[model samples]
Target: MTWAVLLALAGAFCLALGSALQERDAIRAPGASVARIGFLWHLVRRPRWLAGSLAAAAGVCLHLAALSAAPLTIVQPLGVSGLLFAIVLSALFTRRRVRLGQLLAGLAVMAGLAGLVTLFPHSADSPVLPIPVALALTGCVTAVGAAGYLAAHWLPAGARAVLLAVLGGAALGTTSALARVVAARAAADPVSVLDWLTLLAVAVAVFGGLLQQNAYRTGHFAAAYATLLVVDPVVGAGIGVLVLGERVPTTPFDQVLAAGAALLAIAGTAVLARARNRNPEALRPASSPSTDLVHTTPGESS
Candidate 1:
């Protein structure tokens, strides 16, 4: 269990680094639409972006290893810490001082994670979802994602971004659950790599990436990111309990503490998302002729 926790934290760190690097490059690409195939072409040629991709791939590999050892409930909430990690990394790389709100948010996230780890009991049972259950879960996630995607186009820019991010998070959560099942099966039988579950997971991941990119393009980075932070774990943890049959403390006091901790983590993310830049120069709007071509701080978007 300790190993699993460490792996999850390591994965979160890598993911945060990757997101910061990629978003830095991604924002520089003008006229790149999420709906078009050319959207990522500009980034593909950039060495820094490529390095970010490699880092993200490493994070995924570590995440899969963590899933193989720990229940999704334990792993998913911990993944929320990635945003906290990103804030610190962004400050360091950008040579900016960390804001008080960002520091407080980080502390809140850590407190929540500590509470969860200390209160949640370890489960030795395998997190294997039967085919029927997995199919049902996939169907539900698809329906919700589709709804959110459609609604995004109908809403105002800020709200649209948040809705799109929520959809992205849902897809990501589903992918995580599917990946866990696939990993478990592969450990038992190597042939499980060829299973439909693996293909579905890949498809969901692709779709989620598209949603996330669209959200980034919407220009309300803080709200979109905060929404993703909250939704991803809620969806993932719900599936963990329902599909994976992971157990949590049933006592009222433990339940309250768990819920409070989750809320604190989410509140921390929201606070960090709204954190203002201490550097006045960093706050200036881009003067580029193309409104689409703008640079954003890593902590603000990714």
Candidate 2:
């Protein structure tokens, strides 16, 4: 248990660092696709891109380690630290400024994320017929993500990033959920390790990476980070309760408070998303070329 905890923390640290580096690189090289080997090679030629990629790789490794040690519900929410890392580091490293509203949004994300994680039940159980259910859930999540990505045209770049972040969040969240399921089911058999969950994890990691890249491609740093940070946990929490059979707190007051926190997080994300979508009003045309040149102009010409 102690080892598992350590691994999960390591994963979180790596992911947060990777997230910050990814944000910085995205700002510096908007819309550069690293999927193409040639394009990836092109980026690697630059030290910054290479460093960012390395950080991201480290994050992936850490996350896997964390999964080995901790429950997905507990560990996945903690990964929301990426939002704070990206926001603060972006300001420091890239000199990108965050507005007061954005700061408030960040706080909202943290509050909600922390509350949700603390609220998770600490129980372990294995499920029957896990593979089919896991695959079905994955398919449904992927379909929704595809639809959202296709519908991004109606949104501005910032909103687009947020929406895409939601997809990434869902992907990772489901991965965590499935991971726990796999671990529980296979706890008794060594051979159980070789199951559908491993393939799902790989798919989740790959797609999650691409979605993150897409989020950064839109040139809105805060929105991209906040959306991913906020959505991932919310999705994970839902999976914790729904799929894992973990019972949420039953007290009326506690339930109310949790609901309110969820609302705050959702509201904050929506406000930020809308603000990002709303274009600034057109600037007043510059004063017509000065016509009052006056007699001084004629004398000067002479």
Candidate 3:
């Protein structure tokens, strides 16, 4: 594997590690501050959160550097490794088990992602979008993210997880897009240190971190993670094709196979979400069904 691919994989591992640490912290705090606020505060005091954040920062830095060398297609597929890393780390650290369905679903998603990555070329040519266009795109992304954030908060935990996942996914997609722009600029014309991209990179990393933490806090880890994982690649890949003008690998057969894989992933997530919804643990289950439990029967009272 190329250094760029290695760096991208490392970034994914950092993200996975950070998320697992955050989840560990969440389990400890009863009535934890909502994931967003709690994660921000945790970053202030907790050594683990700090370590995780620093790791994430390192990952982002590496990713930025990798973007300098590789295409979004190559870089983005490597990100799916984050979910794998998270699952493995979670099992090692917490002994938390993932369901069979979730595992299969994850595999499906990764397979599709890998296929997509292989199908696209790794050229460094980035489209020269006008500043206004970039700004407009950023605005749209932020608006959608904000709307999802609001919706997550408004709904109960399950729904909240779904919405937060959407937000996290979008945040990631935008981050990757920004990374491409930076890479392209660097590739096309030598730019100085700390340019427009430097600022956007920081924003994307921080915001994505915050929102992703919220995703963990809003609901069960499996469902939230699956949703976020699914959405991020789809969005990123879509942008890569539409905005970056990357060519998809040819052959109708590959396209059909990729679509099937995507469908399996989506179907798996939908099943997981619905199962979570039906399970009593996801919500505040009703109290005892027996009305008489609170008061003695008439005969007993007498």
Candidate 4:
């Protein structure tokens, strides 16, 4: 169990570091190309982003292993530590002094999300959504993602990053719900996984991943990452309650606390977005104009 906890923590760290590494390369990529799908073509050639992807994949595997070893009540809350990990990793990679506000904001996000999930005390069992519910969720994700992508062009870089992250997170959450359904059915009927629900989940997951990349390209790492973390579980919890028939019923007081936690997470994301002017470039933008990843030696300047 102790090893499981350690692995969970390690998974969080890997995820945070992976995002930081990916952002480092994304920022240095051509903004003009990044604004389009072409940036992926350009980014795939970068060693750093590939390494980041591998790290993220490893994190997911580790997290799954931890979940198999531990309970959801313990594992889910530990996920919040990823936000704190992101703060530390970003500061270390950027070689910037950690600002009080950034640290506090990260804690706020972590605490808010931790509180929000801990209130539920969910079980490890997977509750699959019905096909109709899965399709509806997919439609909602599609609509929201399309709208956010269109609106993103008009917003400032920081705000754009947060918006895209939220969209991506929501879509991914929906994918998770649908995935449970698909997996359960696939186990009983191996060929049944080729249904519409599985297709929808795959589509939403792909679109969500693209949205995540767009968020990174905006170069507001903390705000975007925190927002994504907040929205993903929030959306998942919402589906669990509203769609899954509240297997773990909450009291009215619990609902209020959950709302408060959501607000705190939002506030923290705003603080990160509006980084102190004195350290204007610290959280404001991720990478410098120079493509340091290309010229600088390895282990020098994230």
Candidate 5:
């Protein structure tokens, strides 16, 4: 259990820092919109985005390992604590000072995570969904993603950020739920990791990440990142309950405690998100237009 907690925190750190790096580089990618495949084509070629991708990939591995060792509910909340790491990383990169509000909010997030880990006693449950159910879920995810992507274009900037982030977080959360099942199956049979469900999960994660990139492009990191963190766990928690037969604390005292912890975490997430937004350095792009196009990427001229 201790190892699982450590792994989850480490994964969260990598993910937060990697996302910051990737978003910083992405904003510099020669475009205002992330709708075109050409936008991402340029990002992959950049050295920093590639490094960030590697870090985020490592985060996924660590997160999966933590999921295999503990319940989805237990491990997911800790991911929220990544906001602190993001704050520090943003400060370091932008050369800005961290403010008092951000510090307090970060502590609140940590307290909630500590409470959640201490209260939750459920171990991981092996996921087993019927074939029809899996297909239906897959179809729903695809349809929603398609719809959301189109809808984002029609909406205003602020609304677009929220919509994309919510959809992206939900997709990633669904991936986490599927990963739990895949991880469990892997322990029983290594070859089973390549099954249909596993493939679907991988696909969904990629789709989610693409949406996330679009959200970051909106230049509203607070709305996008905070929404992503909050929605991801909520979606995963729902799936864990509906499909995996997971539940929250049944005892009255524990239930109260859990509710309080959730509130604290949510509040902290919002506060930290707003703080990042106000800080000049959160995800600022390159000052020079020429530097933005310095790299000879795909379909691009240096």
Candidate 6:
């Protein structure tokens, strides 16, 4: 269990670093369309972006190993640490001072995580759900995510970013669940690389990545990333309980504490988002003269 926790934390750090690096690259790209293949084609040429991809891949491997060793409940919340790591990394790389709100947000997230770890009841030995059940749940999650993606465009800009982020988080959570099952199965027997679940996981990762990049392009990074941090574990926890049959504390006090902790984490994310939006120059794209050009007479120009 200790090893699992350590791996999850390490994975979170890697993911945060990767995301920050990728965001830097993505912001400088010519186009921000989520469905545009050309966007990736442009980004792939950047060495920093490629390095970030490698880091993210490493994180995924670590995350998978952690999932196989421990229960989802334990691993998922720890993944929230990625946001903190990202904020710190951004500050260091940008040589900017961290805001009080950001610091408080980080503390809130950590406190919430600690509360969850202490109050929630998790069993490391829970049996994996049958393949059929997992498939059904995955299908349902995919359908909902698809619906969310389709509906996101109609929303206002900020809301749209958040909705897309939530959908991305859902995709990631579903992929994690599928990965956990595949890892458990592979432990007992050789699993095919071309298995449906494996392919599904790959598809989800791609979809989620596209959504995240779009969010970073179209909205404030803090808002989108915060939404992702909050939504991913929530979706993961639901799947963990319904599909994975993981047990939670049945006591009312413990349930309340867990709920409070979750809310705290979410509220903290909201704070961070607001703070980031207030001062977003670091993440904002450079303004083009054409966009800010004003017509004037020749004398005025002189």
Question: Which candidate number maximizes lDDT?
Answer: 4
TM-score of 4: 0.85
TM-score per model over all chains: 0.73, 0.71, 0.72, 0.85, 0.76, 0.77
**Clashes by residue pair, model 6:** none
Clashes of each: 0, 3, 0, 0, 0, 0
> Best to worst by TM-score, what's the order?
4, 6, 5, 1, 3, 2
Rate residue 60 of model 4 by lDDT. 85
Q: How many backbone clashes does candidate 1 have?
A: 0
**Pairing residues by index, what is the TM-score of model 5?**
0.76
lDDT of 4 by residue, 14-100 (tens): 898898888777766643312454556667788999999899888888898899999876887787788888877776776767788
Residue-level lDDT of model 5, residues 81-118, one tens digit each, is 77778767766765667777776877786677557645
lDDT of 1 at 174: 85
Each model's lDDT comes to: 0.67, 0.62, 0.63, 0.75, 0.72, 0.68
TM-score (C-alpha) between model 2 and the true structure: 0.71
Candidate 3 residue 40 C-alpha distance from true site, Å: 2.0
Model 1, 1-302: lDDT tens digits are: 99999999899889878866765554454542233334555567889888978988898788889989998778866775776677666567556776776667767866665566545655656797777777777787778877776655556545556677888889987887788778778888999889889988888887787677666555444445556666665676677787788777789999999889878866765565455543232233333423233223222322
Q: Which of 3 and 4 is the better model by TM-score?
A: 4
- CA shift at 130, candidate 5, in angstroms? 2.0
Question: How much is 278 displaced in model 4, in angstroms?
Answer: 11
Best by TM-score: 4
Q: In candidate 2, what residue range of length 10 has the lowest lDDT sum?
A: 293-302
For residue 80, model 6's alpha carbon misses the true position, in angstroms, by 4.0
